[model samples]
Target: MHLLVCGGTGCRASASDSITESLKERLQEHNLQDEVQVVMTGCFGFCEKGPIVKVLPDNTFYTEVSPEDTREIVEEHLVKGRQVDRLLYQAPEGGRVKDSKHMDFYKKQIRIALRNCGFIDPESIDEYIARDGYFALGTALNEMEPRQVIDQIKESGLRGRGGGGFPAGLKWEFASKNEADQKYVVCNADEGDPGAFMDRSILEGDPHAVLEAMAICGYATGADKGLIYIRAEYPLAIKRLKIAIEQAREYGMLGESIFDSPFNFDIQLRYGAGAFVCGEETALIHSMEGERGEPTFKPPFPAESGYLGKPTNVNNVETYANVPVIINKGADWFSQIGTEKSTGTKVFALAGKVNNVGLIEVPMGTTLREVIFEIGGGIKGGKKFKAVQTGGPSGGCLTEEHLDTPIDFDNLLAVGSMMGSGGMIVLDEDDCMVSVAKFFLEFTVEESCGKCAPCRVGNKRMYELLERITQGKAEKKDLQRLNNMCHVIADTSLCGLGQTAPSPVLSTMKNFWNEYVAHVEDQRCPAGSCKDLMRYEIIPENCVGCTACARKCPVGAITGERKQVHEIDQDKCIKCGACLEACKFDAVTIK
Candidate 1:
């Protein structure tokens, strides 16, 4: 029997480490420590119910397992051989789900890249090996030639899981064609999207998978060295990656003559300063080479010259995570899983407004409706679904009409969005589209490398236009100017950061034009999200005149005698909504 406790960063923040120790101590008290092994594994993807604990053999899964509950879990479930009904995941339809396999969240998920994540103790290389961890690398080194490996990847149709969705094999072939004496394989772990954590989770949970994949990539592209360009913000992931690399080297899985073959490959780590622009390939290479993290023109692509001017193939962490699986399962088998064009599953960080906010992986061609509704458990608090922002700040906001749209590189792009590192942020009806656009623009503006005038100047101008709209100070002509400027920036920007910086504005304007019109023409925020456009009024009938709101008003915006109706002084009203919170009668309402 085994007890698997979630050791992912999210769960750790919730004191899952204490829960692990408590469980072990309880097992020792019962003299069952040897009988039942306690293991701390990576993320389970179902972050909503973490910190989770799963019992092996019986397949009993527990949700929100606190350290205090560890006693009952060990007593009833471990020792008594009975399940803890209260701790089991409650199904939306009523019954308790015994295990993850039966849960709706995992029903649609196909965990290929996340295969070992929630299953093994990430710190243990032996546990990783037991699960066929380095089998793919061994196979690649022993059986397959360099060109054959590349061809298999091509046949699998595995596109890069990074924003670009470029063909992985084609990139390898490009790097291979270059006659550089020194070549490199770089894993882009600098995931800077607003809600994206796919790359970080993979590294934390399955670092070996990425290391093995990079070695495979090194062989395929004739690259002798690999570098992981990860952000310093990810301490846990960096720690696990360092451990995995050292273990791989110690075990002869990495270093010279791996599997007794002629291939000599090793991996090193490069720390990023969490610059969003560094997510781009050239910018990442530049950062790795001790230069300012700014993007340059791409005539000399990373494949031709990168990382101190060598042939370098750059693929993100999730992209590399899929490599070993493709090698283990035949290319044809992997290719047949998804749509004809995009053949493989994609990992997504499903965040915001959604009830089941967590990491999810689904086959390509899965509808947004299925992911948002079924897998995500619908919008929180039963609020009406408004939109979903895919591909981070750079990707566009998709609406209800696009719910049934198949999710793939081509399909998302066709609907004015991109599969950008798989950050899916769901929005509700209460969310203001205008504000959403402004928020993304603000992020883009702050993160801009300032390499080009279009991104530096144009995005600031666009942000100011949005600010005016939200403040009810913009005319209808400003809308036209904003629209035209979006095109100008997108067309003129030198790099992808500037090019896609206008996506949020363009998408919100396209999908929620009425919201923009309300903000502009009516001088009102439809969602009541913009503070400047909101007016708090007292409902005369609802106000009991107890002076609760008046006492709470910081700026003295309310005035009335006791036991009488109150009125707000609009001139003094700061729109702080303090009265709304202080009122017991619910008299204050935003208009």
Candidate 2:
């Protein structure tokens, strides 16, 4: 029997390490340590109830487990074969889910890229092998030709998950067609999207799977050398990747001939400084060549001239992770799972305001409503769902109207959003759309490489306009100006990063125009998020005249005598809401 504990970063932060130690200690005390094996695996993806401990054979999933409960888990579940009642996942509606297979969170998810995660110990290469890990690489090298492998991928309809949605097979075919003495396969692991940890989690959980897929890519593209351009900030992912590479070499799977074939392949790591612009292919290529990470115009795509001026093929970590599974399962099987245009499953870092905050993988045709409401366990705190931001900073905000829309690349694009590296941030009723637009614009302004004037200047201008609107200082004409600038920037920008920077502003304007109008015309923030547009006042009827609000006012904005109604000086009020928090009688209110 194996006890798998969630070793992913989120669970680890929530004291999973202590839970593991406590479990081991308790198991040892009962002299059942030898009989039972406790393993620390990567993310289980159901992170809302994390520090997860799953018992094998029966597959009893224990959630939100603390160190104190470890003894009961061992004694009752491990020894007596009785499952812990309270630790089992309880649904939001009602009823306890003893089995993960029966849980709503895991029901719709089809784990292809995340197959090995939360199932195996990532450090152990043997564990990966036992799960048919290297079988795809071996099959490609031993039986299939380079062209045949490419054809299989083409038939599978696998598109890049990293923003562009370019066909993976076509990219390899393009690289294979280009004749060069040395070719390269580059894995873009420098994931820069805010609220996104999809690539990092994948690398941490299934490092060997990436290595195997890279090797397959090398054979298909006629590239002997491979490089993974990952961020320096991902220390745990880097460590695991290094270990996986070293182990693969030791097992004769990565270096020289693989599966006793004449093909030669090896992989190395290149560290990135976490530049958001580096998510762009050309900018990433420049960074790898020891130059400033700025995007260069592409007529000569990376397939023709890339990585020290050689024929190179670049694919993101998620894209490559799917290759092995597609190969092993065959194109027909994988293609049948998703929509006609989009094949296979997509992995998303499901975060922000959602009830179930974690990682999730669903078929390409899965509706946003299902992902946000059912799979994500609905909006956090039962708040009304306002909008959802897919595709990170570059993507647009999708409203309730787009709830039933299928989550494919083209579907998302049609709705003013794109599937940008699969970062889905859910926004609720309390979130201000104007403030949201301003937030994303701020990110783009900071992350813009500044090579293109449209992104560097136009984005800054857009941000300023959004700021002005949020502060209740903008004229109605400024709204039209903002719209025109967004179109110009999208039309003129050199790369995808710059082109999509105005998506948030445009999307919010389209969906929540009333909110923007309220900010400007009425000089009010509808969500009460913008401090400049907020006015704190004392409700005379509700006031008990306790002098609490008056004393707690930071700027002495509230003046009153004991047992008398308090009045707020709007000019003196900083809109800090300090008085509201201090008033036990609920006298202070926002105007």
Candidate 3:
């Protein structure tokens, strides 16, 4: 018997740390600690009801467990044989209480990429071993040939998950086919996309999963050393990774003579200093070698010449997570999961206006409707779904019209969006499309490595255009200029950073053109988002005033006598929303 508590970032924020500590203490007190091993695992997804707690053997999933309830869990379940009925997830539609397996969110997901994410304690090598960790490396070394392993991956139809969607096996073949004395295998764990935690979560939850997969990759590609280029901001992930590597070395998994095999493969960590542009392969390689994180033109490609000018193969965390599963299950079993072009599953950090926001891994061809409605539990506040911004800042927004579009590499590309590292941010009608575009552009401008002139200057200028539009300083010519810059940046930029920087602006302009037009032509923000176009006005009819608004205004913009209607000084108003909160009668209205 085992108890798994969600220790992922989201659950951590919700006080799962206390729950874990309390559960451990309570179990020890009850003296059932020997019978049921309590494990602090990573996210169980289903984040809406987090922090999640799962008991194995019976597989009883308890959602929203507070620290105080840890005693109840230990006493009732450990002492008695009765299952706690009230703690189980109450289905959104109020049906019978079911376990995690019966839930709709997990029903559609075939978790090839996230197989070990929620199930095992990342810090423990034994838990990882229970789930068949290091088995793939052992199998590869003992039974199979290196070329045969590569060929199996080639037949699996797996593509890269790091936005580019290149063929994974083909990329490996490129590195393997290249004859070099010193070769490299880099796990591109520097996941910099906003609202994307799939890579980070995998590293935090299942660091050994990546470690084993990278070893498999090293043996397949004829490489002996592996490097995980992870962002420095992921402190927990780095800690877990270090622990896993040390354990593997102690157990003869990472260092020389792994399971007494002739093949030698080991891994090291290179910390990336939070550069969004460094997510690019070449730039990541450059940063790893203590150079500036900037992308170079890809002619030689990472496979031919990467880290220290060696034959290299770089795949993101999600891509590598699938390698072990693909090898163990065979290419045919893996290929049957998704569409013809995109094989296996994709993990997405489903965030924004969605209710059940969490880490989800769905089959490749599943429609956005299913992801949004079935898995996500629909939009929050019952607001109408406006658009979904896929692929982070680089990828475009998809409107209601594109909801049914199957989520695959080529299909997403066909509609001006790419399945970028799977950061699916849902938006509702209240979210201004113009603001959304500007916000992404702002992020891109800040994160740009500024390697080339077009990306450096063009993206900043494009962001300026968006700023002007939102500020009502934009003209008709500005729209034409925005369109022109989009093409220029896309065509002339050095790498994917510059090339896809214009996606948000272009996507919004194409899908939400009317909103952009209103901002420019009418000089008004239709969605009431732009503060420059809005003023806090007192509703005299609803106001008892009572000097509350005047006293509460931080800027002293409001002036009023006792129990009199307040008048806001237009020049003094900063639109900080202080007066709106202070007014008891809902008198303050933004116009």
Residue 243 in candidate 2 has what lDDT? Answer: 94
Which segments of model 3 are wrong by more than 4 Å? 1-106, 562-564
Better of 1 and 3 by lDDT: 1
Q: What is the full ranking by lDDT, best candidate first?
A: 1, 2, 3
Model 3 C-alpha lDDT per residue in residues 206-317, reported as the tens digit of each score: 8998999899888888899999998889999999999999999999898887788887889999998899988899999999999998888888898899999999999999
RMSD, each candidate, Å? Answer: 8.1, 7.7, 7.9
Model 1 per-residue lDDT tens digits across residues 1-591:
999998765577789999999999999999999999999996665665788899998778999889999999999988788899999999879899887778776657799999998899888899999999899999998899999999999999999899988999999999999998899999999999998998899899989999999999999999989999999999999999999999999999899999999999999999999999999999999999999999999989988988899999999899899999999998999998889999899999999998778998999999998898767766777678999999988899999999999999999999999999999999998999999999999999999999899999999999999999999999999999999999999999999999999999999999999999999999998888898988899999999999999999999989999999999999899998899999999899988
Q: CA lDDT of each candidate?
A: 0.92, 0.91, 0.89
At residue 207, candidate 2 shows an lDDT of 94
Mind sharing the TM-score for model 1?
0.83
Best of the two (2, 3) by TM-score = 2
Clashes of each: 0, 0, 0
Off by over 4 Å in 1: 1-107
Task: Assess the local accuracy of residue 476 in candidate 1 as a C-alpha lDDT between 0 and 100.
Answer: 96
Residue 139 in model 1: lDDT: 95
Query: What TM-score does structure 3 among the candidates reach?
Result: 0.83
Model 2, poorest ten-residue lDDT window? 374-383
